[model samples]
Target: MPTASGSRARGASDEEPLRPAFDGPLARRPAALVARLRQRAVPSHWSSWSGVVSFGCLLVLVVTGLLLALLYDPSGALVRYGGSYSLLRGVEMSRAFASTLHLSFDVSGGLLLRQAHHWAALVLPASLILQLATTFFTGAFRRPRQWSWVLLVGVLGLALVSGWSGYALPDDTLSGTGLRIVQGVTLGLPLVGTGLSWLLFGGELPGTVIPRLYVLHLAAPVLLVLLVVARARSALRHGPVQFPGPGRTEDDVVGFPAWPTAAVRAAGLLVSTVGLLVLMGATLVVSPVWRYGPSSPGHAFAGSQPDWYTAFLDGALRLVPPGWEVVWLGRTWTLAVLVPLAVIGTSSLVLASYPFLESRVTGDRRDHRLLDRPRDVPTRTALGVAGVTVYVVLWAAGSADLVATQFRVSFEGVIWTLRAALLVGPLVAGLVTRQVCATLRAADRDRVDHGVESGRILRSPDGGYEEPRDALGAAQRWTLTRAAAPAARPSPPGSGADARRG
Candidate 1:
């Protein structure tokens, strides 16, 4: 052999240098993964962004809520407030109210954070409602997505509870009135009403309800996050539902990729949402507890109204006729409370089970990956509109007092009008919406059968005026022609298909 050092160098050169993991195939693997992620298609439609907006609001709520929770005192004990605001100075109030006043006046950025939390709470429910509507109109709840719909409805219910609990945490006059209403509603339950009320309040009206609510309020978010994550994962597993278009099939997805396109858009949306909430907080004053003094069972502020999300329940209660109570089984039954409870509960049950109901009626069990245009399903569209009309009527009824005062109208007259609307509005809306949907579907079919009018008038050889038409593009034509065909009614038992199969 040559020299030992020369032999070692030769061996190393011949075997090739040992490469580190970061420099080997693994190095290119991450890049390849990133590239693949960048190319993964995401739905870019405006309607697809509603869930993102809701999630953005939820994030804002969590952040601001945590910040506020650090300084909040959720106690119902009596305390004397001697804060910066002169109006409520030396006033006897709950610890909750005193801390609220202190946060508003003493702590830096506390009020802004509190208002941001409030605004985010308001926006979260609205966004969830919008998302639910979009899902309903598009038939996204069909087949495998039915569970997702149920999850979304559950999330919405949790949000409503969380908002109501947070609203009560301030222990102000308005919120106190809301809590009293809750206590009454709880106590209105049949047989077990008193026990339930005691369990909830821990004894009496303001006993330990605030502490109980605080626990519930915190627990709601945790459950919400878990449900949301589950919903998101389910959506990813099922893939996104896309609108009908050329080159798009039930099995195909067409949109921008997830990495840069969706990532950038979502980031932009989150920033914009946060900025808007902050601006609202800085400029608008919401729930001024100082003006309301503090919680007291005997006192309630005039013109007080619950937040919009809970307004329907308030309106429902207001709309019930007086003396709607009955004696049954040697106990009193308050139909005023029971009626609204039954109506709202039944409506929610119907809504949550609608997908299955439609499936059974239609008898079409195929997986639906492409969304149905609202016009393609006239009856469903009409039903959704009708339900919305009912909700709007209820929501408006909640502000009946304000409407009466503002317009110099009769309070009873407003109540009566809303009551009538509660009965008649949905029917009218359903009929009109169905007609409109039918008309739109007809127009779409016409557009498909006949090319679009080009508005170009020309003189024919015989000197008659003629208008040229332009053919629709492949995507436009497909969109117009892809409406769901009407389902054939089932043949009578043992009549046609069943007999043939038999």
Candidate 2:
């Protein structure tokens, strides 16, 4: 019943047609949205940078690995090497080894890429470990972030597998020795031993192992990429955990945002990591295949050792007592191999499930966005130290032969000593670490309840002298008192109350 102009006016007045709800931030005032995103907070702690370092190392590994994969052959078929390296002029080696030599000397910057790849592989695991350690110590693996911890553990396991597979791909003497050891271990299993060995090797000791390892080497990174992406998404969903401090709480994070601040810092870290790796590659030598020559079944040299990251497992194998086979149900059981595998597997399982286990034990179902100080959780900190002690002792045991030779000690004595330490060291470390953490917690309690001593003596009118004290700032007070541990009861020695009582 309205006129056309009136109708138009009525339509115009009907709230401007909604515009599809802006289709997310992109369709909105994108500039403003971006500004808001840039203002988002991240944790400013140094430990927070560990994730950045790990991701950067992973990127470097991928780039260098892709470049190296272009030229390196994976065939185990023997061929005569005719490369420019004078030492190995006419040596018969696997096609894999020949191609490795060709890539090292014939291809431009091949050695650099190889070395960089190796270095990045090494650094990736180290950075991941650092991330895990920081997350564990800070109690950041609670509640919603539990799966994030599991993903990290999976990534680390894959990294180790990828590294060991790559090591076997070079087909050098050292790598062949490693492969031989792997074969022996695989064949030591009970029922599935032969099947897995045949599946892996395709025949006997070095039979087509290089190609299979190449497949694993390639596939591992792809899986790693998937897991890393998943972990990042999970982290984004859960948000970053922050250390407890003034105005910081479980409800919010306190630091730089992702857009320009965290992004710029992460970019800088990536550049520095890549540059350092390149520099090391240019100057240092790693896994020189030409020097080691082609692998033969009987060509293992004494003093050859696996990479540092795998040293713990190697050390575990070394620490096992020999002649540990048992005849059970008419089948010989290799207890030496089985025992280490069982122990390591159990330890890894414990580590991966620790957050859930702790939560279950403590009945703490609440979400945690604020991190705990190590001293605030003495038992947990002690357990972590104990685990680390076990790993260190085992790692040291890997180089038992070298230690014996270098330090002028008996090999048997060195092995026995490490075995004893492996049993006793963790207990000692746990006790000491727990006592230290308790002492620190008590100190924190004292600092929070009573001000710190200013070291200035003030004489009361009654002629008794007392040291003045300075009250902590709000931030310091919050940091000291934010921990969940209950405060100590007695006043600390030399405190104002204790001085007055004295």
Candidate 3:
């Protein structure tokens, strides 16, 4: 062999040298992680930020929630509040409510963190809704990404239930009233309703419900985190969906690397989200339990309203006409509650199975890497618009009482109008949205086939005036032409004879 230094130099030049395993104490792990991250494929900018923001918000929520949980009590035992608030200095209240007040008014930095937690909870659902709508309108839930959509819906449902349970944990008059309504609705089901109510409340109303709800609220987030991880992993495996453009293909991914570029972008977003949450927490007052007294069975809460997420159900309850209950064999069947419950349940079921339903209807089972323009899929886009219209109308109807009081209109009139809108609005929206989609599709076809009008008058050979036309670029042409083509249905396996005949 040559001299040791010469041999080492030759090896470094001729072949790749091995990376140092232990540069310093505990250095290998970080270096390896950085290398791995650098190779990770990430989606384009617009599609990546929603998930980053959602993750950041959820992290903040978890940290703040865990800290707050250490100071919370879910029991119904009596206690006296002697905190900073002068109004409730010596008032006797339930332990749950008293602890909530103490957390809000007594502990250092507790109030700010608690409010931030609440804001994060609200942001979580909003982010999920935006992400869901993006996926739905972009047709990203097809083929390899089916599980991603299912996981997202599951996470959203769990998040809503967790928020509802957290709301009930305060044990204030408002929350207590909401809990009572929940109990009543749970008990109003036909067959398994009574058993389900018993399972929830133990024996009857107010039977060890708070502790159970507390456990659920705590556990729900962990499950959501797991589901989110699964969703992300599936996306990584299947690769991100793309829009048709130049130098783009179904087999190749075109985007930024995950290490320095994407990671830095996510880090910036995390910092900004935390800063915004802090600013909001420091100023905004949410769920002021002090204003509402402790839970009292004898008192009735006037103007009782659920949170915005639960308002649709509240609106449904409000819009239902009274005296719709039927009593049979010592059991009561409340049509007002049961019918709404049925409608919501059916809607949720349809929503969860929508990807499969769409696939069967369209007979398109091919793996799609490019997204279809909304106008290309007119019927599906129209259905999405109609669904959103129905949801918004119902959400507005939930605030019927407030609307009536503010506008000096009859509450009955508002309810009746909302009921009619709830029925007619979706139908009209579907029709209008379908027409708009068709119009857009037609315009796209015209632009792709013939050039767009340039608004310049040109003299023809016969002395007639005509407008000049501008040709579309390659990328625009590709987007519209590819989308205009009908989806290719996948052939069944073992169809070689049929293929040959064709």
For each candidate, what is the lDDT? 0.85, 0.85, 0.81
Single out the weakest 10-residue window by summed lDDT for candidate 3: 493-502
Q: Against the true structure, whose TM-score is highest?
A: 1
TM-score of every candidate relative to the true structure: 0.90, 0.89, 0.88
Candidate 3 to truth, TM = 0.88
Q: How many residue pairs clash in each candidate?
A: 0, 0, 0
Per-residue lDDT for 1-502 in model 1, tens only? 5554224643446656677766868687887877766656676678888887888789989999999889889899998888899988888998888999889999999999999899999999999999899999999999889989999999999999899989999998999998898999999999889999988788888899888889989999999999999999998788778776554556656677777777799889888988898899999999888878799999977788999999998988999997799999998999999999999999999888888899999897888777888988889999999999989999998899999999999999999999999999999999999999988888877777888899999999998998988887666765675563423222212211101100
Better of 2 and 3 by TM-score: 2
List all candidate RMSDs to the true structure.
8.5, 7.9, 6.6
Candidate 1 to truth, TM: 0.90
Rank by TM-score, descending? 1, 2, 3
Q: Which wins on lDDT, candidate 1 or candidate 3?
A: 1
* Candidate 2: clashing pairs of residues: none
Clashes of 2: 0
lDDT score at residue 49, model 1, on the 0-100 scale: 83
Better of 1 and 2 by TM-score: 1
